[model samples]
Target: MAFENPSRERIGDILASAGNIAIVGLSDKSDRTSYMVAYAMQNKGYRIIPVNPMVDGEILGEKCYHSLAEIPEPVDIVNVFRRSEFCAELAREAAAIGAKVLWLQQGVVSQEAAEIAAEAGMTAIMDRCIKVEEAITMQGRTRKTQ
Candidate 1:
């Protein structure tokens, strides 16, 4: 069967409720999309946990973990920046750590990985930008108050 992303409202709810976001394959470089997105999310009050095996130190002022399992605290969302081929393993790790959501970044879609997350009772979102969704969601909320 084909994979489908959650509804925009659902995505908004996920982002609104999410506190700790573990970014896999996050880069230390500021020019990277992962870094930019994570930085934005951090500024928006979400705790960004950098999970990059390559980075020795912090990426966005938070301690960089080697993997999701290495993170000491609970994770609300496992945002992946890796390629499609690497998502299944990351999904498994995210599930093992009891993450509430498995979010695959834009251009990174995997039916197998989505299925893995679904089977584990995790909300799996594929081929979307978390930062973009958050921006849209936040805008909607702001307009609703106006």
Candidate 2:
């Protein structure tokens, strides 16, 4: 069967409606793409929850969790920054945690991960940047400050 690609309208809806995003693999390093993207999204008013096992403290002032399941509240979206090969595991974890969306950033794609999220009835976005999506979605609107 051919996989479903979310329509532009739906993608825009997901980008704008998701309230909280769990940014997996976000590190303290400012130069990391994960950090840069998270910063952009946060500046757009999306609450960012950092998930990195190696991170001892918080990133972007939000407490970092070792895993998505450890997060205290519902995750509107699980934005993965890990390697493509590892997304399946993250997808399973996101499913287990009951996330509403599974987002694999640019250069990251996994059929297994996509299947896992789709099977669990979660919205899945692959090979896309949440920040870019948000920026485009916010065009002509008043941008919010982080």
Candidate 3:
């Protein structure tokens, strides 16, 4: 069976309900897309867990983990910043960690990864920006600045 993303309402629901977001390939650099996106989500009230092995310390004031498995708490979503070719493994990790959603950033899509997520009973969204979705669904809402 082919993989499919949730409907618009479902997407909005996912955005509204999710709290902890594990961002794979997240960078500490403020100029990077990952950092900016993660910052936005953090401002929107979701906990951002940075998963990147290159530089380890703190990013966006949160401790960075090398992988999803290292996170201590349950993750609601796994937001990937890697290329399409890297998604399948990340999907498996997200499922293993009991994440409810696997979100691929814009311009990234992998049918194999989506299928894996579906088989694991996780929602898979590709080629879409999580930040954009939050802004759309949470319009007119004030984000926390702290």
Candidate 4:
């Protein structure tokens, strides 16, 4: 059977419940999509941990780590910005750290990645933009109340 992503409501719940997001392959440059997306998520109250071996010091005022294994604190989400080929290994790392969600940013997807997450009992989201989903879903919830 194929892996299925959680419902939109559940995605919202995951976003709301998660506090820290470890973005693998995150770039320090503002022009980069990874940087912009991570910055937006940070503004939404989620702590952003940048994972990039090329960068030193801080990317977004938070200390950057070289890999998921290096993150000292518990990570709620492991958002990947790397290519599809790299996701499988990331999936294993996410599972190893016990992350709640394994999210592949827009245009990045891997069945192996999703399966790995599913096998490890983690929510897997593929080919989706976390920032877009967070905005749309959260806005819909707000509109319902108003």
- Estimate the TM-score of every prediction: 0.94, 0.92, 0.93, 0.93
- Candidate 2 vs 4: which has more TM-score: 4
Best TM-score among the predictions, by candidate number: 1
lDDT of 4 at 9: 92
What are the candidates' C-alpha RMSDs? 3.2, 2.4, 2.7, 3.4
Candidate 2 contains a number of clashing pairs equal to 0
Q: Is candidate 2 or candidate 3 better by TM-score?
A: 3
What's the lDDT for all of these models? Answer: 0.91, 0.87, 0.90, 0.90
Candidate 2 off by > 4 Å: 141-146
Residue by residue across 1-146, what tens digits does model 3's lDDT show?
66666777778888877889999999999999999999998887899999998967999999999999999998999999999999999999999999999999999999999999999999999999999988786676443322
Better of 1 and 2 by lDDT: 1
Model 2 residue 107 distance off true place after TM-score fit, in angstroms: 0.3
Across 28-68, the per-residue lDDT of candidate 2 in tens digits comes to 89999999999888887889999999998899899999998
**In model 3, which residue pairs have backbone atoms overlapping below 3 Å?**
none
User: Model 3 reaches what TM-score against the true structure?
Assistant: 0.93
Backbone clash numbers for all candidates listed: 0, 0, 0, 0
**Tens digit per residue, CA lDDT, model 4, 1-146:** 77677898988888877888999999999999999999998887789999999998899899999999999999999999999999999999999999989999999989999999999999999999999999877864432110
Given candidate 4, what's the lDDT at residue 20? 87
What stretches of model 4 exceed 4 Å from their correct place?
Answer: 140-146
